[model samples]
Target: MSAPARRILLVKTALDGHWRGLSVVARALRDAGFHVIMGGMITGPEIVRAAIDEDVDLVGLNVGGHAAVVERIIAELRAARPELPIFAGGVLPPSTCRRLAELGVETYPPGSSLEQIVEAAQRLTGVEAGKA
Candidate 1:
């Protein structure tokens, strides 16, 4: 049998209520054999708790311009699980992307292909594509 799929937790850092892109990305990850857990909209503490509770290998933050919220979530997640890899998607400003890059998180701004996101997930989780 194939190995258990790597778990990825996805959350919205703000109440943007934009689910279209997140849904597509989730589907792509699932199709690529990664087990995806949708956390909806949550706070930094809630995200930290969920990440630990779910035992996810990677975390995806959806922050549509809420740079501060995203930063806080990243900080909390890093504190609790310092080695857990993280990537982000949504309407991120160039500045926000740079900040996230500095923190070692990958950022996919608007127009990033689903393929790119999936590849990043695999890279972060250390799972090969279609073998996650």
Candidate 2:
């Protein structure tokens, strides 16, 4: 029998009110067979609560700015789900990306291809590249 689809929670930690990037990424992950939970432009506490409630396999942060915000969200998620995998994308500067990497969350800044993002999801979630 096939395995159940991995659940991924995608959240925007930035308050910028942008949804295009996260929406597109959600579509890609869903097409790649992930069960995506979209948490739009929420705060740190909300992100943590949703992550816990969803029982997500991975947390994808859509950061528009303020690495500290994303950082705090990462910490909260880790505290709640220590072994859960997390990834981030959207307009991350090199230093912010480096900082997130230091925290063990993969960052996909601009110029990142959809294929690469899909591959990261597969790698982080331990799902085969071509499978759900």
Candidate 3:
């Protein structure tokens, strides 16, 4: 039998309400044959709850604020699910990207391609094309 589709949870870390980037990324992930859950602007607790409730295999964060805030959310997620893989993308400056990188969360800043993001998702989730 075929394996079930790998599920991804995409969330906005801040109340930015910017959907364009997330929309494009979601579409790409969907097209790549992953089940993506769009968790619109939510707090760290909400993100944690959704991550657990949805039983996602990977988490994609759309960051639009200080790196410290994202750090906290990442911490919360790690505490809840130590093995869950997490990645992020947004208007992150070089310094902020480095900060997230230090925390082990891959960052895809502006100008990152949808193909690249999709590849990261596959790698992070261990769901290669035609195999998920």
Across residues 15-101, which tens digit of lDDT does each residue of candidate 3 receive? 898899899999999988999999999999999999999999999999988888999999999999999999999989999988888
The superposed Cα distance between candidate 1 and the true structure at residue 99, in angstroms, equals 0.8
- List the candidates' TM-scores in order: 0.96, 0.96, 0.96
Which residue pairs clash in candidate 2?
none
Per-residue C-alpha lDDT of model 2 across residues 40-131, encoded as one tens digit per residue: 87888888889889889998998888888888888888888899999999989999999999999999998898999999999999988888
Model 3's number of clashes is: 0
List residue ranges in candidate 3 displaced over 4 A.
none
lDDT of 1 at 17: 96
Native-vs-model 3 lDDT?
0.91
Sorting all predicted structures by lDDT, with the top scorer first, yields: 3, 1, 2
Better of 2 and 3 by lDDT: 3
Name the lDDT of candidate 2.
Answer: 0.89
Q: Cα miss at 53, model 2 (Å)?
A: 1.1
Taking all chains together, the TM-score of candidate 2 against the true structure is: 0.96
Q: Write the per-residue lDDT of candidate 1 for residues 36-98, one digit (tens) a residue.
A: 999998889999999999999999998875688788889999899999999999989999999
